[model samples]
Target: MELFAALERDDYEELLFCQDKASGLKAIIAIHDTTLGPALGGTRMWTYASEEEAIIDALRLAKGMTYKNAVSGLNLGGGKTVIIGDPKKDKNEAMFRAFGRYIQGLNGRYITAEDVGTTEEDMNIIYEETDYVTGTSPSYGSSGNPSPATAYGVYQGMKAAAKAAFGTDSLEGRTVAVQGVGNVAFSLCKHLYEEGAQLIVTDINKEAVRRTVETYGAKAVDPADIISVDCDIYAPCALGATINDDSLPLIKAKVIAGAANNQLKEPRHGDALHGLGIVYAPDYVINAGGVINIADELNGYNKERAYKQVAKIYDSITRVLEISRTSGLPSYAAADHLAQERISMLKNSRSTFLRDGHHTLSRRQLRG
Candidate 1:
């Protein structure tokens, strides 16, 4: 990829490449924007086939974070980091500490958390080197794991979508086709099951699918057949691009809401969903629970306050749908419009500042 061209096209603020030979850590950090505040996002570790792929992933994820934070009403911008390696095999204390040092070097232009291949334990490791990390273990007075909070937020958003599509917010008799049964989805399934939603679950991991079936009495389906299943909601808890061309034609769900990031393969797919009268709870808006939970750490993590913020996702989803209906735009476009409007207003209101002064400082600085 032409790196500068991509940055220009995406309006990214900064991108940094970090290499540490001693720990064999090679990572890319992309800060898409800090117009709202300091950039904050998660660190994803994946075994990409090429450097270009990793760069693209970081860029796309960073931009998504900007939108996610903005729409979620956080005083933060968007940034993301990608460590190009196998998390299972390549992770070592030295590597994470080295990565943390790089984050610290930014002086809190960016804050990192856990995503995908990374974990709260990994964030704790990063915390050992710098304070600009969230999702650390509760022993450190942090938010701990964010998956359950994210799952809860998605559940709330799903209920909002259900209200939009089925004239009620209850999932009591809804059949939901779940695309993946990972950690967040596992927690999500529990909520759906408690609400008496029938689940048809599929995952690349057969063991995960089997466990969901056994635990929740969810029906098992072939992974490839999940999109076409007759269901009230299609919940994607897996990777991005699941709502693209092929799957769009097969989806039978009236409501689309899940924890996945970047669900649309392309912008047009969202339009296609809107054309079909499908209610789409924007992925970032629905999934902001995790970030909301983590962002609480910045103000001295409080579970009650964090959960209260997450519960507001229902209202946010309602507003997004209202925007879609009144403006005749896809739900995704409506969400973008809302977020961009916030960013623009904030940008104009704070025009005099060259720096946003939203940096995350270490405990020492906080104490001082």
Candidate 2:
């Protein structure tokens, strides 16, 4: 299980990988850091095209988690695990247990939670093998799915973006185009519709498209067509990197915010967006609501606390937009600056005694 590292910034650490010969389960776990505390993130199951691609995803996702947690004011570092196989076809009880074994081996240097392709039952199976997972069934006293909370966060963040772009902080009567109508997007569409935003939606799944159309009276468009619909907000909830060079030219939205994991084809794409005057809510910052929910389990699961944390998504998005405007940078670059600022502050605030581990700093000294 040896490999090369991906192109990385100076802020991360590569961790463990496990491949089960018996079940053909391949998982790469990337832990960015444990400086703040234990690295907390999610297990994403997908059919990656190549090992390189999988590694790249794990690395990028893990780094994003670090920023996401830090800027969101969580005392958790970032780690991410990616299982290389189609969750719909390649997943089984044994396969998940194998992954659970991988987490068990980490000894809580990293923790796993729910993500795009993983479900509560999958977490349950992982639970069977390791005590390193969360976001499970309600019987397990966990939030079964974070879609609604995630959607609520996005809705709040979108409202913030709307306020930044327009004077009003409401979605009512705004034209919002949603690129996917999955569980979270479904709730998002309902929220938008309830607020009287005209909804334009697209999905490869016909049943989902029909359902969204029925539920929210959204106009259905092809995925390719969804991006250029000239809406007030463009939400790409399906996948990442939809805002690359070729497609970025056609985007007409004033605000770009969604639940997708990795939206930039490359870091420069952020700059390209900035040049075009699009207000982007960097993927990780806006989508941290789910991770925030799962991480809340560590603190006795207070709904009020979760709500407060989720509300930060709005502030975070607004800050990114503000930075982008003032610095003449893309929202992604602005977010990176903000994250780096927070991390640097954390490092600076640690007293010399605390840094050396010979003496301890008071909480006041640690709060710098």
Candidate 3:
């Protein structure tokens, strides 16, 4: 890949490749922007098909984190790390410790946390080598698994979307088609079930589906058939690019709100959803609860305060929808606009250097 050209195109700050032959660690760290503060994001461990694919994923996710943090009102920039290996087979204490040392070498330019294939235990291991990791166990005085908090934020965002589309936020009796019943979606289904929302859930993992069905009485369906299912809200708690050309035409849901990232295959997909009168809770805006929860650790973790901040996701969704209506832009575009405006404003407001201290590197320094 043309690394410099890609970074220039996306306005990325820095991208680092870390390799530890002894521990079999091959990782890519992408810091998209640090105008707000140090780049704070999670480290995802996955089995990528190729190194190029891993780089692309890291770059895209890092850019998304910048927007997510900015829109969520956090004084942080965006960054992401991807470990290109099978998490099930490749993870080890030595590998994570080696990775943590690489993070420490960055001198606080990026803070890491648990993501996808990684866990709180992994964060604890990383913490042993560096103090720049969040989302560790309660013993470390950090927020525990962020999935539950993320689910809560998505649930609240879903209700906000319902209010926008159906004139009421109460999901009672509403049918929601959940695309995946992973850790976050499992908790989300519990919330939906308690609120009297009928659930139609699907997942590649049959055991996960079975567990959700047994616990919440969710109706299980084939994964491929989920988009066409009749439902009020299509909650994609799985991976990205689900709302592509093929599934867009078949989606029967009035609202699309879920915990997934990069749900739109392309920018045009967001326009297409808008044309269909679908209320889309911008993925980054709605699913930032995990980041929000973890960011609180920087200020000394407080569950109550963190949850209170997550509840404001509803407000963020409402504002995004309002921007979409007033500006005649797609919801996703509106969210980007809102985040960009804040970033620009902050960049100008904080242009002057402070004598006390600086939490983030200068833009020029970050670019280097």
Candidate 4:
């Protein structure tokens, strides 16, 4: 692969390849941008089919983080690290410690947290080497689990979307069809139930579906039937790309907001939603609560402060919808516009400041 060309295409700042023979660590770190501040993202460990695949995943995730952090109004850039191995059987203390040292080598330019296939325990190991890590055990001044915080953000974003689509943010009598009953979705269901929103839920895991049905009084449906269910909102909490061609025509929701990443199968799918007048709370923006909560750890980890910041996701989604209306763009494209606009504004401000600083220095030298 043309590595340099790949980085250039996306304006990636740096890509580091780390290896440790002793611990069998082979990792790639992709830093996509740093205009806002130091890059902050999570490290993911996966059993990728090939090195190229892992590299592509890291680059894609890093770019997504850039937009996620930008739209969430965090002073963080975007970067991601991927360890090429099976998380279940390949994790070891030495491996994480070696990885941590590599992160330390970058100074504070990159900060990492726990991601899929990586846990707080793994982050703790990384923490032992460098402090540029978040999502460690709560005993170490870290926010314990981010699931509830993420759920809260989604719920808030959903309300904003509902306001845009139904002219009322109140979900008291709304019908919400949830496609998964995972930790985050379960918490979201709790919020909706308390707000008097009837839930129709489904999951591949029968036990998970049963739990949601029992606790929140949600009606159980088959996973295949979730998209076509007669509901005001369809919350896809399980898999990515569910909004593809087959499901697009089947979706009956006025608003699509959930915890799943990459909800749109492709960019065009977003346009399809826009054509149908469906209000889509962009996945990364609505699901940024976990990252926001993790980011608060950089300021010494305050629960109240973290949650307060996460609650702003509602405003973020609202702003995205406004941008869509004003720009005549799909909600997904509007989200990208919002993030790019922020980054461009900051870049321009910095450029002007540097130019002014150079003039001041030149004048001072002449006087001297």
How big is the positional error of residue 265 in model 3, measured in Å on the Cα after superposition?
A: 0.6
270 in model 3: Cα distance from truth in Å?
Answer: 0.1
Tens digits of lDDT, candidate 1, 1-368? 78899999979999999999988999999999998888999999999999999999999999999999999999999999999999889999999999999999999899999998999889989998999999999999998999999999999999999999989999998999999999999999999999999999999999999899999999999988999999999999999999988888888899999999999999999999999999999999999999999999999999999999999999999999999999999999999999999999988766644366644554457899
How far off is residue 135 in model 2, in Å? 0.6
> What residue runs in model 3 are displaced by over 4 Å at the alpha carbon?
352-368
Candidate 1: C-alpha lDDT: 0.95
lDDT of each: 0.95, 0.84, 0.95, 0.92
The candidate with the higher TM-score, 3 or 4, is 3
Question: Runs in model 1 with CA error above 4 Å?
Answer: 352-368
- Candidate 4, superposed: residue stretches over 4 Å from native: 358-368
TM-score: model 1 vs. ground truth: 0.95
Q: Estimate, for each residue in 1-368, the C-alpha lDDT of model 3 and write its tens digit.
A: 88899999989999999999999999999999998889999999999999999999999999999999999999999999999999988899999999999999998999998888999999999999999999999988999899999999999999999999999999999999999999999999999999999999999999999999999999999999999999999999898999999998899999999999899999999999999999999999999999999999998999999999999999999999988988889999999998899998877766643433656566568989
Determine the C-alpha RMSD for candidate 3 after optimal superposition of all C-alphas.
Answer: 3.5
Error of 4 at 185 (Å): 1.7
lDDT of 2 by residue, 239-269 (tens): 7889898888789899898988888889888
lDDT of 3: 0.95
Q: Give every collision pair in model 3.
A: none
What lDDT tens digits, residue by residue, belong to model 4 across residues 1-368? Answer: 99999999989999999999999999999999999988998888989999998998899889989999999989999999999999989889999999999999998889998876788889999999998898899999899777889999999999999999999999999999999888889999999999999999999999999999999999999999999999999998985789999999898899999998778888999999999999999999999999999999877999999999999999999999999988889999999988999999999988998888753343236769
